[model samples]
Target chain A: MSDDFERNLREHLHSEAEETREFPRRLRGRIRDGIAPRTRARMAPQLALAGALVLVAVAVLVVRNPHVIFTDVPSTIKSIFQQPTPSPTPQPFTCTDRSGGTTGASSQLSTIRTAPHDGYDRIVFEFSGQIPSYDLSRQDSATFVRDASGQPVTLDGSVGIKLVFRNTDAASGVQADAKPALISVKEIAQIGNFERVLSYGIGLASSQCVRVLELSGPARLVVDVATTASASTTAAPTPLPTQPAATDLGQFSCLDHSGGVDSGSAMQLTHVRVAHQAGFDRIVFEFAPQPGATAHLPAYTLSRQASAKFIKDPSGQPVTMRGSAGLRVVFHGASGATSYSESRDQTPNLPVVQEVAQLGDFEAVLSWGAGLSRASCLRTLELSNPTRLVIDVQTP
Target chain B: MLMDPTLGRVIERWRDGDRDAFEEVVDRYGLQLLRTARLILRDQALAEDAIQETFLKAWQRIGSLRDEDPGPWLTRIAMNESISTYRRRHRFQALTERFGRLGGGKVEVSTEARLDLAQALDRLTAEQRAAVALHYYQDLSVEDTARLLKVPVDTMKSRLKTALRRLRELTGSDEALA
Candidate 1:
């Protein structure tokens, strides 16, 4: 090529590069505009309704919403009850500590107590609850307990109570149920030093509500003695409030006990727990007061692109939503009392909250309910602190 | 129901007037927009401002967007705003030049032999310089260059050809060409 031609082309290209500057300007503008949120806020109610329905269906098909009460027995257990073993229906036996099969007699609720037994805090119950006389090999749990004392009876100094059923040989004719069992814990009265009622609004399956009746060291344990209810009748048992739906925003990791627990499903807040995950979100505000401290909100409210939601206390109390736009929730308590909030929508601030002084070293799931779908409990906090308030919100 | 199409529809509806739709939009795109702005602006604070402004403008003029291509449109607006900022500074430079006060000199191009070429380029009209930049560095077609500048196709070609001729004479590169 001629030198003049090559030089001319080079000059031409150089000029071209210069014009490209405008291209960047234009491209930049477009990119900027693209990032902006659309102004149209008009969703057709039908569309929303449709979306809600689709979400509901997806949730239903994906996994049962933990909140919705399923009248039918869970499919997992349906088949076991469907096929029966051939034979005459065995009479109910009342023998204790006997490993009987499908025909084992059901025991009635007898007496319940919490003593420092076996070197651990033991919430023992004498089962007189009705059950099949022979062993019902299929898995089923049938014991219930609660902190009827209004205050949560710490389980061997642990956050949760453990029910250990001992099948000591009872008098003759007293039968023992087999394999799977149900246990429930309900709080009834106030006891000990912990002020903010621990298990105030907790719900347990009627069947599981028999194991350890955590009374306020004084409530009565009325063992509802009845004939053995048919296996078919009790086959489809209801779950405790802790069960959550499939699509619920599963879990989060909060920094401390003050973390929030929430769900897009918008269900009633039942339980909450702090868990560990890859990253963090915001904290949650529990309406229930802290167990034993005067409620003083932390000094700083976290700010970020994410958000936080204030959930209702399991006891169904309204929590205070403070901060810039009701984003920060605060639950005022009586002097020297405490409350909790699971970190939902984010990983809550750990060291900031007052109660998380001790490294509780436990993660939990927070659950809630919505009109269309039951929200799944999520783990929104890392137990980066001790003495963390690990709430277990059950889906409604 | 499939949600992707419905999400688009929801956005369209939100643009219509349901006040709560604004929040939905914010919830849906807040992080995404923040990210886009950050990529474009580089400065975190500036990116935030850009995103905020982008949303503001979208809210204000969303009614104009009748087509489904909201993304490119929005991005264009943001780019224009940023460029407008650049233009303002450029205007200041022009003002300074009018007073015979030179602003910051251009970064000297790499090759000294190219220095004369660069100075010669400095001497060319801004339109000619832009044509060269787009054609050579940006690798745009003459047709695209014209469309971008809103000039005729032939005009772009002529400007390019003229720039080459000038460079050839200034550099005395006929021997190299042979």
Candidate 2:
């Protein structure tokens, strides 16, 4: 854009560049501070550069701290097994399990990781030896207190879960506040290390159902927070709200129960009604068939579900979440949009039914999901004369 | 630059994990690297940070350095660190600043005679600022500057030309820049 500077100006600028300056003050100290990890002195005079070319960035997480055999944990452990189906009995919200002491090379809390899964976000605390006795409980607020000094440690999200491991110590930088970018499990930070117990706080986007499990081989404490309600709601951690009282029929099965015939006018669903019955809550799926008084109800199936997402088979898409837990209801030889005039998704927020969602309607198979506050036992009934399928969910 | 007879042994000692010998390298080049970094970044504090990261990286990967003369290699590291810091800051704060440099020719340059040339260099992009500091202020040859920056000779010349033109427009010190 412009020609070269005049020769006289070029000479002047070159002279100005010759000005000398002193070295920056405290630069050596700053550089030393950056490499705060263990610095090995020349272990051998004839050590090769290849051997000395160790960058601590890779080992920083694992080798920061070392501990000997763990000791002084609770002797008795009540390690409860994970429930495969919704439990009729109430379970403790807090963990009281103890891991017996064992002699080992290192018994330190070495790594902390946070990840987001298909329907939940997982945070893992990995230890080098037998995992020490741990107590993990949900806190009402996100703020926490340091173990010994009692100073407050504030976290980022709204919900909090504090986990403490007795007779264990974490590496210095094992837990940083670098939470994963927008997820339910917000921040997992090591808030305190007093005496021999190591404490960590997990921040969440909202009140969530947290599942804790202990694994062997490397002995890691794995915690999973449901992205949506898996089996229990946060407010009713013990004795899920769906547990039936003595008057209702016993819940002997969490399996799918099916009935009704697939013949008669393709069963175009027309109206849906929900009500609280004597011993159960009812969802009625009424169909209009050929404007006739006599028609057979369509075949259908009902089962308890882990989540509302049906990524395979009929739904073929990610279904949205309504309540904490879900029940999937599938109907065969039925039409979803053929007769229904009202909205498919309903947020009734009833005592037993929090939401009624149309998960998918394809290939003459109709799928609907009921989002509930907690897992519940359900039974189905088929009625004739302008066919209807009634689902009665047993309630507390 | 020719290799200093003692500088070779100092680098060897550093590779052998001698902290003092590495500190000696910093004593030798810290001032020169500071000037280049300050001009490229135009921030006193960030230039210092660039030098700190430069030496830290040097310690971590010094075994890979292949030459006897540490000056050019050290300058290469410091220059790269400075440019990286410049890019990271602008990327997070002002992505549009890349296209709207020099106020997009909208805001008028100050009428008062400028006191700090570093302020005017900020109007140029990070690459232009680096090229100016290397070829003009640091007195490196065009080809040598291109080699240090890992850019083509024609690209380096283009940057120097466009950057010099804008420098004259802002500082009105054209006679000295050419």
Candidate 3:
């Protein structure tokens, strides 16, 4: 390589390096005080023995008198034990409108603010008057629609929470059209109607548990969404389920019954694509319309298989896929009348999914297999209109 | 390579257990280590981890290093750590696959220039990538680069030759290499 090439490469790499802000300062302190890795390795056995002893003691106590363990345990120990395992399950949060009807007086939504906390992000909607009675519900996608015009309102996240406030308007102290205050809350669409209800759609990065709180002085409605699975909490009295089994279907376990199957026409699988996201790898199947078709969404089953092999059409030969682990997705209500042209999409460098293959559309029970680098947490979403079946496998 | 007298004293003091001296070493070499690791690993967070582990190891074994200047030694450690991290992470993913579990930066360049270089760099093997990083970015001579990589000088020369050829092909910059 010439000196020019070397110099250019150096300049190129240097330009891409992130700004060296506090790294040197921060690393300097850590190096000064940090324990040596070898020392840590040397101490491992002793630490393991100590840990085992404590676990043994705790088990014996629980067997001897379980109630005593809970009652006499230190708060710190209790908190540690109570710290919820980060599961993708949505925690239940419900706040009913206490005010029977609109108070006849309208309140203006003044300012929107967002702040990040330890495990959650908060969005506060400040109002000029009394906090309005509202209804909030989670949706598969956060696109808010104008109730009057029925046009879809675009928001930032795949998942959303719709907030509808009664006898409120955005016209008073704030702009009628205002963007969301935070990245997680994609957009705050103001649906000001003459009747009484003022609605806003809150978009989120992904599905998260939302907690609604009402505060006074200058009245405000605050929503807190867990930024991470572990950060999720519920103000409701229901105790969470114990840690799920290793193979438990996490976020995909819940059934979204909102869009009923169109029973009239057969659904045609049109296109398939795969992409990697921040926390998961996604496979999308697009479905096309059949005239007078009432689409039926069959109860699909997702399972991991030992090998990435599928029985080929007509030949009866097994086709091997690119990954070590194979995910078989069988859509029950699909029509086999229109056979899909088999295609394989490869994403070799991704952490989870490696390849996605259209195994067979035999008998309209559309089946596809995804070759994953490893077994992963899998979730599915069925979107309507230009129907799409989305499967997201979370990277560990 | 020229040695900094001040950095040389700091290395001696660090070996003698002066914590402030270690800080000086970090201040001087931390960014360079980070840049080299980032080039090798192609991920900012992973690069940071490799550099951190490298420095920690350097601190632990500071007494054993007899070199008057610590730059090359530190760079070698950082390079090894980055490559190790890349392999270890991929190995963990492969292991988890058998059990059927799915688990799983900076530049001053114009965004486009940096992106073009990053994409081109991704095509090289890890050995080639490391050799280029140390030789070009760190300005180590071919002999020193070979020594740091623990390969023959001719082997280092071949690696650089192939890496630059591949990069030029990818970026369509034959003239730049010429």
Best by lDDT: 2
Say which prediction, candidate 1 or candidate 2, comes out ahead on TM-score. 2
Off by over 4 Å in 2: A1-20, A36-396, B92-94, B101-118, B173-178
- lDDT tens digits, residue span B75-131, model 3: 878878987887786676435443542332111233245336679897566678899
Off by over 4 Å in 1: A1-396, B1-4, B19-42, B88-106, B109-178
Looking at model 3 chain A, report the run of 10 residues with the lowest lDDT sum.
A94-103
Superposed by TM-score, candidate 1 places the C-alpha of residue A42 at a distance from the truth, in angstroms, of 20
| TM-score of each model, in listed order | 0.26, 0.35, 0.34
lDDT agreement of model 2 with the native: 0.67
Model 2 over residues A290-384: C-alpha lDDT tens digits? 66634767777676665544332231334556666777777777876767887777887777687887766765667788888666656666776
On a 0 to 100 scale, what is the lDDT of residue B37 in model 3?
A: 84
Q: What is the descending DockQ order?
A: 3, 2, 1
Lowest-scoring 10 consecutive residues by lDDT in candidate 2 chain A?
A68-77
Per-residue alpha-carbon lDDT of model 1 for A1-396, expressed as tens digits? Answer: 235455455555444333321112222333333444434445566678989998888577547555442533366367677886443333232211112211222333344444322212223334444321211111011212343343323221101212212122233332222111223323221122121111112122222212112222222222211112232122122323322342254432111113333211111222233332222222333222244533332221121111122333222222222121122222111111122334333323332221111111111122221110122122322232232223322223
Best by DockQ: 3
Q: Regarding DockQ, does 1 or 2 come out ahead?
A: 2
Report lDDT (Cα) of residue A209, candidate 2. 67
Residue range B1-178, candidate 1, lDDT tens digits: 1235545655567577644444445434444444433332333445445555666677778788664635445544554444343345357644554454255443233333553554565544445555665565445678876765567999888988877765655555433555
Q: What is the C-alpha RMSD of each candidate to the true structure, in Å?
A: 29.3, 27.2, 28.6
| lDDT (10s digit) by residue, model 3, range A1-396 | 356665778888666664443254334434544532346579999999999999999999999998878786877687887996453343343321112212334787778777877667778888888887565666666666786788887776776777777667765555445454553555555654545567777778766666666777678877877676655443211222323442343454221213335243457777778887766777877777677655545446665555666544312335687777678776655654464554544554577788776665554456677887765545677777777777777665
